[model samples]
Target: MLSKRVFSLLCVAGIAVNGIGLFSGVMMIDGALYALIAKNMVLSGNYEFLTLHGFDWLDKPHFPFWCTALSYRIFGIHDFAYKLPAFIFWLIGALYTYLLARRLHGRNVARIAVLVYLSALHLLLCNSAVNAEPYLTGMIVAAIYHFYRTYREGTFSQLLFGALWAALAVMTKGIFVLIIVGSGFIVLWLVRKEWRQFLNYRWYAAVALVLVFILPELYCLYRQFDARPAVEVFGQTHVSGIRFFFWDSQFGRFFNSGPITGHGDPFFYLHTLLWAFLPWSPLLLFAVYFSFGKRRVAMGHPLLWGSFLITFLLFSASQFQLPHYLNALFPLVSIWTAQLLGNMGRLPANGTMHRIQWYSGMVIVILLCALIVLFHGSGWWVFGIITVGVGLAVLVLTRRVSPSNTFLVSYAIGLLIGIFYGGYLYPGLLTYQGGDRMARFINAHIAEEHYPDRLYVLDLEIENFMLGFRCEVPLQAIRSEKQWDAINDGSLLAIRPEALGEIPDRFEVEPVASFGAYRISRLTSKFFYYRTRDAQLGEFRLVRLKKR
Candidate 1:
C-alpha cells in the first residue's frame, strides 16, 4: 500500500490528466452526434423530442441530452461545455468507486480501486469522448452503493437515493440497466440465503420509486412518439417510443431484433478486456483466478463479482455489443482487482505478480512513445520531451518512495497515456476531421452577410455530423435532385471530392475552402503514418453555388 501523501499526489495527477480531455473537441460519430442533438434541443427549446437533420431521432433515451442541454444553457454551447457534464459524472463515478470499495474492503483497497478506475484505458477514453457510458458508469455504481446501504441499514433515504440513481441509469441507456444493477443484489441475497430480504418492503418501494423517478423519460418518449403516431422513425410511421424504451431499445438489441442491429461475437469483450483493462488486466486475471480457483476465496463481496459476471455474460451473449458497453462494469472490476492487489501479502508468488505489472507498465510506456512518434504533428517534440521528463521523474519518485510499488508505476503510465491522448493524439487527429475544420473556416473566415441561407451537406457522415454541431449555421442534407433543386442561388454546399462530379454542371460552383477529411474515430495504420496519411484522406470542400 502507498503512503497517504504518495496516494494523494497520485490521485491528483490522475484527475488532472483526465481534466485535459474537457478542453478537447467532441469526438466524431457518437460524441458529436449527441452534442448536436443537445445543441438542437437548446435551440429548439423542445426538450421532449430529439431531432437529427430535421427528422425524429429515437435511438437513445433522453437523460444524457437533458443533462448536456442544461449544461449548454448554463455554460454556453462549446466543446468544454458539452464535455463538462460527462466529465463531472465521471468524477462522480470515481467517488462512488472509492466509497463502495471502502465499505466492502478497506481504505487501502478503496484507494487502489479509485486509482484503477481512473486509469482504466477505456474509461479514460470515454471521459474525453463524452458519451452515455460516462453517465451510466457513475449512476450505476451510485445506485449499487446506495442500495447496499439500504440493505445494511434498511433506511428510506438510502432506498430512495438508490432508486433515483437506478432511474437515471435507466434513462441514460434503457431498461437493461436494471439487469446490470439488480442482478448483483439478487445474487448476493441468494448466496446468503437471505430470503426474508427478498420480501423486504424497502426493495419493493425501491422498484416503485425507480418507476416513478423515470416518469420524465417515459413522458418524453410518450410526447415524442406515443402521442404523435404519425411521426416516421426507422422508416416506419406510428412508432412507439414508449415501447422502444421498454423493449426494443434494450432487449431488442440484445436479441438483434432492434431497428439498429449488429452481428456479435461472444468473444468480443473477452479480448477487449485484455487491452481495455491495460496494465491491470494481468492482475485482474490473477484476482479472478485466486477468487474462484480450486481453493475458492471471497472476491470482495458477492455484490461486485455477481454484478460484473452476470453483466459480462449478458453482453457477450447479446447480439449488439460495443467496446464502450463494458465501461460501466469497470467500477466493479476495479474494486475486485483492488481487493486482490491489497491482499498480495497473503497471496503466494506476489513478487511475480508485481513484476508482471511492472513489465506491463513498461510496455504501455513504449506504446505511448511509439504512438507519439508515428502520429507526429505540431508540438509533438514538445509533448515527447515533457512525457519523457515526467516518466523519468515518476520512475525516480516510485523507486525512492516504495521500490516495490508496481501499481503506482502502472497508474503513472496510464496517466502519461491519457495526457498524450487528450493533449496530443486526439486533437491532432481532429485536424483531419473535415466537418469541424470546414465549420471553423466558415466561422472564422466567412462573413455573416455572406453566409448562406442554408448550408447543404452532400452526404450524411460522421464528420458532417460534427460540422452540424460546430457550425454556427444550420446544415441540411442534399441526397436527391429535388433537394438540390430546392437550394437557392448563393447557398453553400459542402461536398466530398468524389461527390463533386455528381453535381449538375448547370449549377456553377465556386470553391470557398477545402479540408482533408478522415474519420478520426476509425484510425488506420495508413492514417497514422504521415507519409501515407494524405492517401488515406478524402477532401471536403465548401463551395458557393449559382444557377447558370
Candidate 2:
C-alpha cells in the first residue's frame, strides 16, 4: 500500500492534471447549449425558466443552469468559470465514492476505489464537456452514500441528507435519479432481508423531503409550460413540460415511446464500456466473472452489482442512449472493481487476473499512442514525447512494484493520458469547431465596427449556442422570411452557408466571414478528406444584408 504522503501527492497530481480540462474549449451541442442557457439567464436576468434561442426549452430541469448562471455571476463568464461548479461537484463525487467504498469494503479498498474513479478515462473527459452528468453523478453518489449510512446506522439525519441529495440529483436530470438511487438500495435491502427498513416512517419522510426540495423545478415547469394552455416544443404544439419531465423524459426515453426516439441496439453499452472505463474495464470484467462464476456473491457490495446491472439493463434496453449516460454508476463500478485489486496479494503474479491487468495496461497505452499518432501526430510533439515517456515509465514501474501497487501505476498512466487528451488534443480539436471560430470572428469585427449597443441579430440554420455565448450578445432566431425582412441594415446576421442559397432577391447580402464547422465526435477519414482536404462539409457565414 502507498503511504499517506505518496497517496496525497498522487491525488493532487491527478487532480491538477485532470483540472487542465477546465480551460479547454466548450463542446458542441449539449455543452454549448447549457452554457448559452446559463449565459442568457445571467444576461437577461430571467432565472426561472429555460430558453433556446428565445423559445421555451423544457427538455431539462433548471438546477444545472442555475448553478452555472450563478458561477458566471461570480467568475465573469468564461468556459473555465462555467465548468467550475461541475468540476467541484465531481470532486465531491470522488469523496462520496470513497466514503461509500470505505463502508462497503475497507480503507485500502476505498483508497483504490478513489484512485480508480479519479483516473477513469471518460470521467475526466466529461469534466471538459461540463454537461449534466457531472452534477447527476456527484449528487446520485452522495445520495447513495448517505442513504447507505442511514440503512446501516438508522439515523434520521442521514436519511434526510440522502433524500436532499437525491432531490438535487433529480433536479439535475429529472426523476431518473430515483431509479439510479433506489434500484441499488432495493437490491441491498433484498440481499440483507431488511424488510423492516422499508417499513420505517423515516424513509417515507425522506421521500416527502425529496418532493419538497424539487418544488423549484416543479414551479419552473408550471410557470413555463403548464401554467398556460399550450406551448410549442420540437415543432409540436401544445406540449406539456411537466408531463415530459415527470413521465416522457425518463420512462418514454427508456421505453422508446417518447417524441424523442432513437434506434436501440442491445449491445450498444456492452462495447461502449470497453473504452469508457479504460485500464479498469478488464478488471471490472474479471470482477464480474469471478464474483458470479466463482460463486463469490458474498464478496464486495451487493449494491454495486444491483445498481450496475439495473442501470446497464435500463440504458441497454432504452431506444435513446448515450455512452456518458452510464457515468453516474461509474463510482459504484470503481468501488466494486477496487474490491479485487485491493485484495491482489491473494493471487500469484502468474494468475489470470494479473495477466489481464498487464495486457489491459499495455492495450490502453498502445491505443492512446496510436490515437495521438493518427489524429495529432505532428503538432503535439511535446505532449507526444511526455505521453510515451510516462507510458514506458508506468510499464517499467509496474514490473518493479508489487501486484497491489501495479494497479496504481496503471491508473496513473490513465491519468497522464487523460491530461494529454484534455490539455492538448481537446484544445487542438476545438480549433476546428467552426461555430467557435465564427463567434470569435464576429467578436473582433463587431468590436472594430463599433456597432450600436443593441444590434438586432438573426440566427438562421446555425442552431448552435456557441455563437451567442462567445459573441457575448443576445441573438434571436429568424424563423421565417418575415423575421428575415425584419432585420435592420445596421444589424448583424449569422447563417449556415447552405441557407445562403435560399436568401430572397429583395435583400443584397455581403458575407463578412465564413468558418468551417463539423462535429469532432463524428470525424472520419471520408469526413476529413471532404471537409478538411477538399473543404466541403459546411461553413457558417456572418453576413450583412440590405434591402435591394
Candidate 3:
C-alpha cells in the first residue's frame, strides 16, 4: 500500500506532467467572448460578457466565468488562465475519485482509479482549454458523491452537501443535474428498499437544500424571465421559468424543439467515451471482465444501475450529441471500474491481464510504426526517430516505480503514441487535411505587426480549429452567399489554393503561405477550397486584400 504522502505527490506529479505539452491556443472558440470576459475583468471588474458581446452569451452558467475571470486577473488571460479552471476542477475530480474509490473498495483500488484518470490523457489535453464539459463533469460528480452519502449512510449534512453540488450542477449545465442526481437516486430507492423508508425526512430537507444551493440559477431565471417586464429565451418573447426546467431545457433539446442543432451521430458518444476515458481502455476492458466476474455480487449497487440508465438514456434520446456531453458520468465509470480492480485482486493476474497489457502496448507500437512508415519522404524519418523517442521516454519512466507494472508500461506507450500524433503524424500525413496552408500565408504576409481580428474562413475543416488555435485568432465561418460577396471589395483573403478554378475573373491569385505540402494560395483541395475567381463566393476569411 502506498503512503498518503506518496500517493498525494504521485497524483499531483502525474496530472501536472500530463498537461504540460498543451498550453497555448487560448483564442479557440472563434468568438471574442473567450478573451472579452477576462478583458472585462481587467477593465470593468465585471465578469459578465452579455453587454460586452452583442448577444447575451448566457448559454453556460456563471461560476466558471467568475473562476476564469479571477484566473485571468492573476495569470493575465493566457492559455494557463483559460485552462486554470479545468485544471483545478480536474484536481477536484482526481481527489473525488480517490475518495469515492476508497469508499467503494479501498486504497489500492483508489490508486488505480487515480492513475486511470490522470492518464485519461484527453481530459488534461482538452481541459487545458476551458470548456463547460470537463468543469461540468467535475461539478456533477462532486454532487453525485455527496448525494450518494445521503442514500448510503443517511447523514443530513451529507444530504445538504449533495444538494449544494446538485444545485451548482443544474446551474452549470442545465438539466443534466437531474440525470446525474435524480435518476441515480431513483434507481437507489428502487433497489435498496430501505431507501424508500429513509426518504421521508431526509428527502424533504434534500429538496430545500437543493433549492437553497440553486438560488443563483433561480435568481437568474426570476430576474431574466419571470420578473422581467419582457424576457426572451428559446425564441419565445417572454419565457416561462417552469417550462425552462422540464421540457424547455431538458426534453426540448432531445426532441429538437429548443433550437439546438448539430449533426447527430448515433455512435458519437461511444467513440467520445472511448477516447475521453482512455489510456484506461484496457482497464475498462478489465472492468467489463470484472463486472461480469462478480456481476451477481455488485449488480445491486445503486451506482451501477443508476449511472448506466441515466447516461444511456440522456445521450440515446438527445437530438444534439457531443462526446463531452457525457462527462458527468465519468466518475461513476471510474468508480465502477475501480470496484472491479479492487475486488478481483484476490484472483491471480493471468491471460486477461496480459492481453490487456499487450493490446495497450501494441497500440503504441502500431501508432509509432505508422508514424515511422508514413514519415518516409517528408524531409523526416519517423521510425528510427520515434523508436528512439519512445525508448528514451520509457527509460526515464521505468526508473521510477509504481504499482501495476502493466499500467506503467501502458502509460509510457500511450504517451509516445499521443504526442507523436500531435507532433508528427499531424504535420506529415494529415497536413493536407486542413486549411493550415492558408493560415501560414496570412501569418507571414500580414505580419505579426498586423494581427487581424476581422478574420474570415472559406473552407471549413477541423483543421481550421488547428490554425485558429495556433495563430491565437478567432475565425468567423462565412455562412451565406451575401457574406461571401462582402469580402471581395479588396480585402486580403485566405482561401484554399485549389479553389482558383472557380474564380469569376474579378480576383487574381496571390500566393500567401504553405503548411506542409499544401500551398495557401488560390488552390488546396478542389471540393472545399475550389479554385474560384468569383470574388463574392462562399466561405472564406478576409484579412487585408490588394486590388487587382
Best by lDDT: 1
Ranking by lDDT: 1, 2, 3
lDDT of 2 by residue, 19-78 (tens): 888988788768888998898888879998788677677778989999999999999888
User: What's the lDDT for all of these models?
Assistant: 0.86, 0.79, 0.57
Model 3 clashing-pair count: 32
Off by over 4 Å in 1: 294-298, 392-404, 479-482, 501-506
Residue-by-residue lDDT tens digits, candidate 3, 1-548: 35678667766657655455345333234212444444444545544332222223335556666676787788875556766776677778878777777776678777866766666656644454346666776777777778777767988888877787777677667765666667766776676665554547787787777767776666655565566536444445666564565466666677777655555666777777777776666666566665566654233246654766667676866788866566666666776655554444344453466456656565556656654554442534644576666755654554433334555565556555545543443334333433444555556655654655645555443345445433434455553566656665444445555554544455555544344333222232232222331232333333344446
Of models 2 and 3, which has the larger lDDT? 2
Once fitted onto the true fold, the runs of candidate 3 whose alpha carbons sit more than 4 angstroms away are 1-10, 27-53, 195-198, 221-247, 262-267, 293-301, 368-403, 414-540, 543-548
Please report how far candidate 2 places residue 296 from its true position, in Å.
4.5
Q: Local error of candidate 2 at 291, Å?
A: 0.9
Query: Which residue pairs in model 2 clash with each other?
Result: none
Q: TM-score of predicted model 2?
A: 0.94
- Top TM-score prediction, candidate number: 1
RMSD of 2: 2.3
